[model samples]
Target: EADTCIADTAVVEVVPLDMTVADSTVVECDSVAEVVVEPVDFSLVDSVEVVEAVDNPSEIRLNWDDVNYIERNTSLGGILDVIVLGDNTEYVGYIIRNNPVSGIRFKTLDNKVHMLKWDDIVIYSRRPLDPEKSILSQSPLISTYTFAGLKPLEGLIVEQDYETGLITIETADGSVQRNSARITNITNRPNENLYTPKRKTTKRRAVY
Candidate 1:
């Protein structure tokens, strides 16, 4: 007959059956409540493999590297997922992916996977076709004259004759009116000059 249990603090001694309450004290209270309430297992430690950010050939400068990944499973945290591999029309810049736990970042636009560094992911390559809008069309007219020297004149005459000089040409119509008139070679052969000028001389001297 053994039964002694008086509550209100300290007095308990009642053992009637076999006892067993030890799994390392419930695994030490679940490892002290998982070390005071879990939540800190971010992995993926490193990766910046942007093989080519381009424009470094003729050299305006822009190259990138850093693809190191071997820390698998610390719970696999943020960032670190950059896979921008070559020729987005030969590249431009800005592919800095990183987030080893809220260092927050990502890239790529016209190629997708956006929204992290979201400065619009910055990726543009398709602008090189403006050689002045395909050039060819400019003639607003300003001439020193040369369509073969603007040739066109048959019987041209204007004279101030004192002995035939200020312009004169009477090769036909019973000739006799000429001061070696060649008016610049008669606009390149106007019907080979078969002139017909019976009189075109006006000289009204003295107006001073």
Candidate 2:
């Protein structure tokens, strides 16, 4: 009777069940996506090289003493690598041949020619004249020479070749002169007006 009473007092509970599906992706063998991941080079990120300073050929540093040094040494037809003091204008040129005119014919590094005779055209340089380039030595004067006790033709000498002893004289501007095969004393002009006049006796001889 106690077991029946316990069974009648026990209550039965029923539970309802429901089913749900999670969404999924469908993959086909032929349509499978390929994700290609290339290997990254970590060394490239830190491979930057240090840049070095380069020197400029045209731009130079110079002082007043350096300029004074150049001014003291620069001469006719002297080749110098230089720059203007205040303006820093650079040039590779010469003082040029002593122009019959007063100016300097400065053949520039660029081949453009100029004259440095302007009183305002100030310049500076540290380099000396090149001994090998552009004849810098003073040439021998042909007029100062004598041929066998004969003086040179007056005001006629222009240039002379020291190697061959050949002499050149200024003739017509564009004409060539033919020289005689031999130079002789026959060409020498006689010295005129060499005699002095005698003064007449001004006083009697001591009154005897």
lDDT of all predictions = 0.27, 0.36
Q: Give each prediction's root-mean-square deviation over alpha carbons.
A: 41.4, 37.8
How well does candidate 2 score on lDDT at residue 173? 39
Best by TM-score: 2
Q: RMSD (Cα, Å) of candidate 2? A: 37.8
lDDT by residue (6-65, candidate 2, tens digit) is 233334332322332223232333332433223332221323444333322235666534
In candidate 1 the C-alpha lDDT for residue 111 amounts to: 49
Best by lDDT: 2
Model 1, 92-208: lDDT tens digits are 222344443332232343444333432222222211122242111111111121123344233323222322243332222322333434334432221211222233334333322
Q: Cα deviation in Å at residue 73, candidate 1?
A: 49
Off by over 4 Å in 2: 1-86, 98-102, 126-208
Clashes of each: 1, 0
Candidate 2 has what TM-score?
0.21
| Ten-residue region with minimum lDDT total, candidate 1 | 134-143
